[model samples]
Target: MAISNVLMFGMVDFSGLLDKFGIDWHLLLIQSLNFVLVAFLLYRFGFRSVARVMDERREKIELGLKYADDMKREKAAFESSRAQRAESARREAEGIVKSAKDGAKAILEQGKMELQQQSAGMILNAEKEIARRRKKILGDAKAEIGTLVVEVAKSVLASQMTDRDRNNYAAMAEKMLP
Candidate 1:
């Protein structure tokens, strides 16, 4: 076939050159088929494997990201629970301290009450002892006064009486006897 009428551009035509080089349509068709076959083979052998590896790597990255997110959520939950527990423990400790303080105050008050009661009882016992001692002293003084009066009367009568007076006194005393 003549390539002279196949103008590549408006001024380029090389029919004689193509005939001299023996280039034909069949050769072009075979070269195009070979290029297509080689491209398909390279795509199947190299690019497909590389793309599959890249896809697997991407999937792993996504999975790692998801796992990291899950771990973060778990850590946050743990911290929240820990904080709540700490708060609860603090409240409980405060309550315990308050209770202890109240108990101590109550005990102190009870001790004061007991001390007052004991002191009052001691004072009462002391007063009773004083009264008893006073009564005893008064009784002893009265006994001593009585004894002194008896002795004085005996002495006075003995000094004033005589033998004749004693005999008349006995006669008067016998007539007056009931």
Candidate 2:
């Protein structure tokens, strides 16, 4: 009740000031009504459309931001997948190279063994040929030495021999020739 009395007292003083200023209540009420009508028309016709457009723009901006974030995540996932594939390819390439090296080594070893076998076979064949040739040469030399000894004995015995002595010496030489 006291607060109401105080508010009424302030209103009385304010009304007296307004009267002194020649502020007519009827003119004030008409102006207030005009202002309210203008404000309502402006809010309904202009501000509502502007607010709707702003809301649409805000939604579009949010969608664009969400799309950008999704794209970033997708790019990160793609990069991770690509890196893993690259690592796998590297390992596969290394494995292929290692296998190739091992295969090459095996081939080289096989070739070396084959070459050694061929060389050993060739050496054995050459040794056999040499031994055969040596044996043939020794036989030929022995035959030639025997023929020379018989011819030398014949010449020496022929120079001093009668037919009877020749026959006896030839029989003895034939017995001793070998």
Candidate 3:
């Protein structure tokens, strides 16, 4: 097998092709060397610049991620503060409503007291007016009774004088003597 591989390598006939084409092996070797040198130079200069730009882009992406995190925290804080203010406003509104309710209750009580006082005053005035009217009626009735007694006494005296004659008056006068 080694013999056959060596024979195959030797019978390749690359020199005949190069001779027919008037190509120099040494010039080919030099051109190959030049290509390797140009590739190395491009790798050192061009590839390094591209790698630097890529590194800068990666750093900018990291910074943007950090900025986004900070914005999220700020938004959370703003929402918390807004919630606190809303609670405070709700408490204040409740207090105001309670105070208004209390005030209304107080006003209602005061009005009731005033109404009671007015009612009592009116009752007292009515009682006083009724008593005055009763007293006036009694006084008028007593005056009428006194006038009737005086007229009855006068009629009795006139009847007794008309029934008696002058002789009966003298006899009654004698009988009345002590």
The numbered model that scores best in TM-score is: 2
lDDT tens readout by residue for model 1, 61-175: 9999999999999999999999999999999999999999999999999999999999999999999989988777766654554445434544667767665665555455445
lDDT of 2 by residue, 49-116 (tens): 99999999999999999999999999999999999999999999999999999999999999999999
Q: What is the lDDT of residue 41 in candidate 1?
A: 97
Which parts of model 1 have CA positions greater than 4 angstroms off? Answer: 1-45, 140-178
List pairs with backbone clashes in candidate 1: none
Best by the lDDT measure:
2
lDDT of 3: 0.75
**What digit string (tens of lDDT, one per residue) describes model 3 on residues 1-178?**
9998887776666666677787987989999999999999998989888889999999998999999999999999999999999999999999999999999999999888888888888888888888887666655554444444334544556555543443454445445433
Go through the candidates in order and give each one's C-alpha lDDT. 0.79, 0.86, 0.75
Q: Residue 20 of candidate 1: its Cα lDDT?
A: 77
The list of candidate 3 runs beyond 4 A from truth reads 1-63, 136-178
Task: Report the CA-based lDDT of candidate 2 relative to the real structure.
Answer: 0.86
The predicted structure with the larger lDDT, 1 or 2, is 2
Q: Candidate 2: lDDT of 14?
A: 96
What value does the lDDT take at residue 38 in candidate 3? 92
